[model samples]
Target: METFNLFHDATDVGPDGSEPEGYLCRAARLGPKLGASRLGMSVYDLPPGEAICPYHFEWTDEEWLVVVTGRPTLRTPEGEHRLEPGDVACFPAGPDGAHYVRNDDEAPARVAMVSTKNEFGIAEYPDSDKVGVWAGDAHYMLRRSGHLDYWEGER
Candidate 1:
């Protein structure tokens, strides 16, 4: 068994958020804490009108977000969702789960993001519907909504 005290000294301030533009404080997986696997838990500080990442969703990995402060507008393929503190959101792996978190407030928004690395996971963007396959370097788009057929077509 292994135990870590992130509150004590495992605070990991991630690389300045530029691609997405935000500040991330990694509370877990800050050190050599994994054993042949990958998992991450981070607290992201998203300034007003800023996004945590590109408008994308995972196909094999599921992600969960817990709002700790301020409100955010969740952009998904389905539509937009406003999230407040204590609001818990989840994105399952699939084309229907295309989503991203954006801070809509003028104040800084903070949320805890939990993610797990899967052997077979792909992330897809909805606005462009661009799909990024994990463990591989390839991206594509679907012609129809909620349509994801791996190894069934060629791009």
Candidate 2:
């Protein structure tokens, strides 16, 4: 039998010292390492002013976030709230689940996000007006403003 600790075990998953600070976070994807197929868990160590992602929602999966250390700010459709260690929140699939997490304090904080996995997934960024789709191996990120007609290019 194999076991992993949510607060300790993790593999690289984010930030990568990129120019876009909006998605910068010391994150690790643990699902793959633990042989997870239908579910996934991502752990993130967020520094001040860093966010996991822009406010978004999933169309096919439900997620839950657990604060492991320090306090992080969570933004949802309702409003922004500070989450302390041991705090947990559930985000159901759809618009009501739209959310964003960031560290607004002087110190760093850790958080774990667990969600259902799907063969294909669709996510939308309301703040950026973009949509993200993933299937097997191909993934696409596009702006919703670029609307296409049903037969725009079809003959």
Candidate 3:
């Protein structure tokens, strides 16, 4: 078994420029390292003014967050709020679970995001008016306004 410490363990991933500037973070992908399947977990060291991801919700996967270090701000439908160390929050699947997390404090923040992984899933991003589709191997990010009738493309 592999032992990983949130406070002292070295992170395996860092700023890669793959994500937008404000969404970047140095992360330790714990799930794969610890042989976790079905469920996914990652510990992120978030820089001040940075975020974990956009405000969105999954169609069927539930997510949980655990704050380990500096205070980070959480934004849900209710509005933005600061979270403290040891704080845990659950985001059920769907619109009611829509949320976003950011390191609003002057110092860096650390948080763990644990979520159930579904082979097929859909996520909606309300802020950007976009939708993400994820299947076993296929993925897509599309605009919410680009909708068409169900039969529009049928012969």
Candidates' lDDT values, in order? Answer: 0.67, 0.89, 0.92
1-155, model 1: which lDDT tens digit per residue?
56544223444555554443342323344224544267656666666776777777776777888888789888777789998988898877776666788887878777777777665666766667556654556444443366667856776
Choose 1 or 2, whichever is better by lDDT. 2
TM-score of each: 0.66, 0.92, 0.95
Q: Pick the candidate with the highest TM-score.
A: 3
Candidate 2 residue lDDT tens string, 110-142: 999999999999999998999999999999999
- Full candidate order by lDDT, most accurate first: 3, 2, 1
> Higher-lDDT candidate among 1 and 3?
3
TM-score of 1: 0.66
CA deviation > 4 Å runs, candidate 2: none
Candidate 1 yields a Cα-based lDDT of: 0.67
For model 3, the run of ten residues with the poorest summed lDDT: 3-12
Measured with C-alpha atoms, the lDDT of residue 65 in candidate 1 is 85
- The prediction achieving the highest lDDT against the true structure is 3
Question: What tens digits encode model 3's per-residue C-alpha lDDT throughout 1-155?
Answer: 98789888877799887898899898999888989889988999999999988999988799999999999999999999999999999999999999999998999999999999877999999989999998888999999999999999799
TM value for model 2: 0.92
lDDT, residue 146, candidate 2? 94
